[model samples]
Target chain A: MKKTTQTPPSSGASKESQMLAMVNRRFFLRSAGIAATTGAFILGACKDHDLDPDMTVDLGSGDIGILNYAYALEQLEAAYYTQVIATPYAGMSAMEMSILTDIRDHEIIHREFFKAALGSSAIPGLEVNFSSVNFNDRASVLGVAKVFEDTGVSAYNGAGKLIADAGYLLLAGKIVSVEARHAAIIRDLLNPNSADFAGDDITDSNGLDLAKSPDMVLPAVAPFITTMISGNNLPK
Target chain B: MNIFKIIDEIQKVDGDAVDRLEYATRRSFLTKFSRNLSAAAVPAVMATIVNKAYAQSPAAIDVLNFALTLEYLEDEFYKMGNAASGLIPSMYQTVFRQIGKHEDQHVKFLAGALGAQAVAKPTFDFSAGGAFPNPFSNFDTFVFLSHAFEDTGVRAYKGQAGNLINDPALLEYALQIHSVEARHAAKARAILSEIRGNADIKPWITLNEGSPAQVYAGDDNTVQGGVDINGIAGKSKEAITEAFDEPLTKDEVLAIASLFIV
Candidate 1:
């Protein structure tokens, strides 16, 4: 079935240009020797609060911790998809573009939702390092997309119990299914008609999807994130 | 007079009501009645009560059994589809095989968890009483039913989350199953699109997908937590629908599953 060419409303806003500007500003700030000082100052401030300066950010405790945890992952996804659309993969079909753009918007909305919900407790904008990913190659991009989406679904699943608040659990449930949808699409794009959709690695013999705790998940995504996330205060 | 208070008052009045009668029986009756009352309306409140009802949360076990029943149906569906000769396309045989294995594993895992409490798998009629006959013999019929079953399974797992909330480990496990079911749903839809040459099919559920509307019911919802998601900047109904999947109630889920269960 051929998908329609309708793009999400924000697709027209030129997020790529904004992302480039942000990158350039970061470059300028670093070259001026101000970035380290700013980082040090933030660390010092955190120390005054009895927070560990060694860790980039502590996710806090209880429901707030869970929300921040979700926020951090959503930030990674939004950044990754934003980059994907910014530099479309070679030989990408219009259908691929449309669906991926939809996924991009969904992740951004999820990221923004957690940000809004957490308010002051939310972690700062996470800097991502996607140097390992080849954005121009469809296989490379889709392969990464599959990992992110599957990881995202499992992360949310694992964290559901950490959220004591029923409202937050419900919210997590809402988002994970969408992530699953993204996972399926990315798998299909990489190898259509392959069993990759419910691959044995991510899913167990019982057909249940894998669930990884923050301790397990944070390290897997660590390479892509420049900011060190400490799940120290999060619920065990 | 409050019925619960009256039950207490009866013990005070006769003083022998507790000694002479079976306390366990009376208490069980009260708990069941209260739960039934709660289940009548306001699902969010009912969910909280159900989850918190721990010593009473054998109710949770009941929920697990319900999940196992659905898993059994799905496992058999995929296994049968894979076994049917010349039914599934050559290109798609491996996909069905993998899905079938997962479903079989799901059945085993759930049954293992339930142990002696696990319910036996019921006989399933894939054709829904001749609604669509010879499903195993027709690839199109099989594909369409597969989509329905996968989607139903996703919702079925989601519907039970509230019931399992008191058990954090179990709740997380159920959530894990829920997402896999969703992945299965997406894959089935994608395959259907490929076979039909319909480019309009999306991996995610859209507002309008035509026929079998029950699958998409409540999916078009835009209002969540007293906020219209569409009211947010750069958001629309379509985007809102795509953002969050709606959960089916247990009754709603059973009604759908019953179509296949004899």
Candidate 2:
């Protein structure tokens, strides 16, 4: 007694175009490195800028810092899922395809939400390196998805306390539950009918979910992120 | 000299001697008397005062007790479902068993934290006052009710975060449990999807799902931060609904939970 609302596969196409745009822009910047730097210098030469905009963006401090940190992770996830759906794994069932697409859309929405919420303070689009993930193999792809989802959940759990703003804290709370849902689904696919849903690795002996600090999470995800993302400024 | 002996002697000599002493002399005597007590005794007194203060301010305890109640309900519901013969399919039996264990652990953890303040587990009917027909006996009814309970559990924890804001540790703890509930909700939804052959049943609650509609009422919200996300390019109303899980107020959560309570 239900109909799976067919979400037009726009996210996959949009992601492709976005990647192309980024590649073109990076190519332009690299070829005209001095010229681009000179232009940046002209813009900042008149004012005493604290640091070069080209340098690695510190995730700021306080609530904004936490938002940017989340934005970075969302960017990675959105990109990963976009690729997953754009080129699905071998022997992917129609059911698997549909759920992964839904996950893709959700991640894109999350990425855009953070981008719009943070606006200028938000870090530039992160370049993800999915070299380790073999998109053609179902197990390989799902393994990476599992890592990203689990890490995303723990990241939000860890960062929730660092957000002093009530609005931001509530937003994080809302988003993390979705992340947790995603994590569970992917885990069930990998190891069905097991305690992997709340696995000992991610949960404590008390059954409480693990809350990894920014420092702990950044490095784990860094291998997937090509951009030098830093969370040094996030609240302790 | 023992301070108690001295006080007793003074009382024996004249009942009013201590009271009639100069104010400065009495102050000095009390100061000396306190100094004679072990250093550890001070913190013991302070601990008693802090404990009393914590007991007095029941907001945190109330939040915990409320959580315990929900956990107890979930634990028992799962136990009944798992124990019911043929209610859960062989393929999904382990899943139910694992989830039931988690719920039991949650009850234990929350009860352990609340210590003596933890509320006793209430007897549950699961049939929702006849709203559901033999929920435990029937697998379909059991799955439907499990979905509701898990979804409600997620929102209940979300609603209590504000109350826990003052204590970061408690807030973090509540959030950790909150996500676990969401995961459980998703697992239940996935199982339903597998059984029904409907891919539309997402792990996250969408605007359209939730049997009574009240489970997902207000979850369709798209305008966050006063910006219409649905209006944005490529984003649909459903995407917004799936992106963020909506919170349920204490009244709303209890209302749903109360259905199962006799």
Candidate 3:
């Protein structure tokens, strides 16, 4: 369940140094004001479009909106999973440890995939601080885990329509099903009867539920993050 | 009289004609009075019209109606699947009951939202018009129906994501429900894999590889294909490997619903 450390590619390019440089540059940007703005301008050109100003957590345009919307959730999940691994929950069982580590790896992969796929259009890697979570308590950690995993699945389900690219949509389906798996495992671990699988909220008498837009999720996630992030420019 | 009473009496001085003239300068006093009388009677005449207009407006009521329908389908399927005792294992009864309860909760939640009664469950003919009949004769039936229901539930949630964006409370509620659906889908995939064995380890599971038949629902393009016997098509490696849910147009969802409703 340990994260597979990336070996330098056959070309011998060391990612460690490169990542260090990236971090240094990020620090430099945060401190060096007007002078750094020039480099930042160049970087911004290559940066993904920020969340759309109009992208409220509502569902209007399908596919693109959904993907950007999911980009946001992945951002949160990647952040959470990153912290959990950084600080292991106390009194963790061997099984919990293994599963959680695997989940972290999966979240990182998901986060990286979205970033790469989104490229210049993807959201900037968000800073997630889980100071409120008690890493020493199993209940606290699992409670947060349940909330996040559940939110991830629901976020994808709610944003499914806003995706435009068939390939991306397929990718989302693949990833979401995995998230669903994570949710079920966590649910079973939490309480036995909680796993409903294919119940009524999603499928209706007519077999349908609503997909929300970024406007809906941003405010909803406000309590979790320190800085405000936008979902406006996701997809028009 | 007190000073206030004196002021009141003076203020109440016959200003009715002046007020009438101020409101309608062009009208004779008699004509203005008559017009006021007519206008007063007009609201009573238009009350019926206003009520009719109000009745015709669609709200989240449409969303509730949609949920009501899907719940009926899900409820009936689980009930019927459980009833055919040979088709389901005794061990899995708890699973079915748990899922059934979720579906029932969903129905109650949606019905409560709509302030309406639950819709009666639909009679699903797993036999596709008897052309390629009931495929789930035993264990395969449960798997097929379970997978189909789970898959359909996931897609249906995707299909309806647009409808609940306005109300934050309901949006959160729907999201909570959606996560449960995803969990169900994953569990079903696991069960299907264990039951069928040699199941493809695709990222997403599908019923057919070369045909339009799917374990959940029809592909966007396949109009004709051999019907799957378990009421669901078998698994496809490519289906889940590269599978993502397709977002449907509002019109498209409406059309799909039309097939089930009278």
Candidate 4:
């Protein structure tokens, strides 16, 4: 029954919407403040961010464990993107710089959000081993970005069933799509307008994206992460 | 958008809903109207309708069938777009082919998963009742509609995640499809950016930025799990909104899907 309202939000209209949105945010936040201070879920063991790589950072089981798992991945991504932007690859174009910067900001936001959500249950800052990556080369930087983004997407996809809390599941649902978005852009940067953006290697004959369990994801990312991670406690 | 009308309709059904939604989490009700609200004055009634829609859903099968219906629409849309003569440029044929194949596969997967309970595929009108008179024959319109369809697919699967929570395996499957749809969305959005030469159009959605409004209604939401995503890492509101894709309600998604259904 709806038609002919095609002219979307104009700049002036968006500004007004932005103001309206701000008011809604305050009202929403004020009403939700007390309840949002959820009890900190205790996991296996907590470590200061400075913990040595030798120490096994156990991602505690259940819902919090999944959040930590996600946090760990986000940490890896944020760190990688941070370094990429700090010292960009050789011959990086303005578009590349702009896109990667946005990605960096996004990964950081995801990492911080999870860290905040998990509270004390969040795992310590993970130590990454980028010795194998040559940051100066665009190929090297983007290649790793692809791996991390794709891994994050699949890991979140696989971890969905393991998350018990509805809030947490919805949270994972929210972030995984963003990661998938990251994965696609990174892939497109490598091969613009090509099938590799959602290539057959990652997607199956049915076109379903790959989904890997914690066990599967941990090892895929193990090369980049030097810190010991224990996922044995994650929900089966 | 009957967002307010829906709220008014909801008030007739439940009285305390407005009060309850006032204190409820964004995932519950704000999510439904998150994208629907414009810069204009919003009535207090948006909350009750939000909560009612958020709180309602049937069995896993019901959700799956709802999903199957969307997959069917996408599958047929792509199948037609792919077959249209001189529609897709040669450079992007592979991209469109891959996306179409995935949609076809999703239809197969969901149908197989639903088995006998699967609903018959509805006849589709890609024009959206003449919204895009040349969706297949016109390249820009084709990609534009593809973006809308794929993005809608991502949100549609997400809106149903809460329903499948009780069945972990089912939920995981839905999520797998959900991310794949996201990947497709990213591909389509990127193609659109390249086509339209609009640098502002990133692969991820920025705010409630997409068309038809309903498909991308709540995407502008910066709040996640009760946390205001603004000021995190000194990111702009646009980046924060882009970082997290919000869930659309089943009712709104149906409103969108209805446009394409004959």
Error of 4 at B128 (Å): 1.8
Candidate 1 per-residue lDDT over residues B1-262, each given as its tens digit: 1223222221232323222222332333344346546555645544543333332245556666677777888888888889899899899898888878878877876666555556667778888878879889999889888888888777677767877665665687689889988888888888887788986777777764534777668877765533444533355557667888878876676667777766
Clashes of 3: 48
Share of reference contacts found in each model: 0.62, 0.61, 0.16, 0.78
- Across B1-262, the per-residue lDDT of candidate 2 in tens digits comes to 1223222221232323222222222233234335656776866654433332232224666677788888998999998889888789888887788778888888877766655445666667787768888898787788888888888888889878877655555677788888888888999888777677787787887874667777777888875544555634355677778888878887776667666665
**Predicted structure with the largest lDDT when compared to the true one:** 4
Best by DockQ: 4
lDDT of candidate 3 over B45-81, digit per residue (tens): 3443333222321333444455556666676667666
> Which 10 consecutive residues of model 1 chain A have the lowest summed lDDT?
A1-10
What is the C-alpha lDDT profile of model 4 across A99-132, one tens digit per residue?
9988888887787677656555568777788889
- Model-by-model DockQ, in order: 0.28, 0.27, 0.11, 0.34
CA shift at B103, candidate 1, in angstroms?
1.3
Off by over 4 Å in 4: A1-54, B1-58
Residue B52 lDDT in model 2? 29
For residue A10, what is the lDDT in candidate 4?
Answer: 46
lDDT to native, each model: 0.71, 0.72, 0.49, 0.75
lDDT for predicted candidate 3 compared with the true structure: 0.49
Q: Locate the minimum summed-lDDT window of 10 residues in model 3 chain A.
A: A34-43
Taking the tens digit of each residue's C-alpha lDDT, what string does model 4 give over B122-201?
Answer: 76888877888999889999888889888988888888898876555457668988998999999898888898999988
Task: Report the lDDT of model 4 for residue B152.
Answer: 89
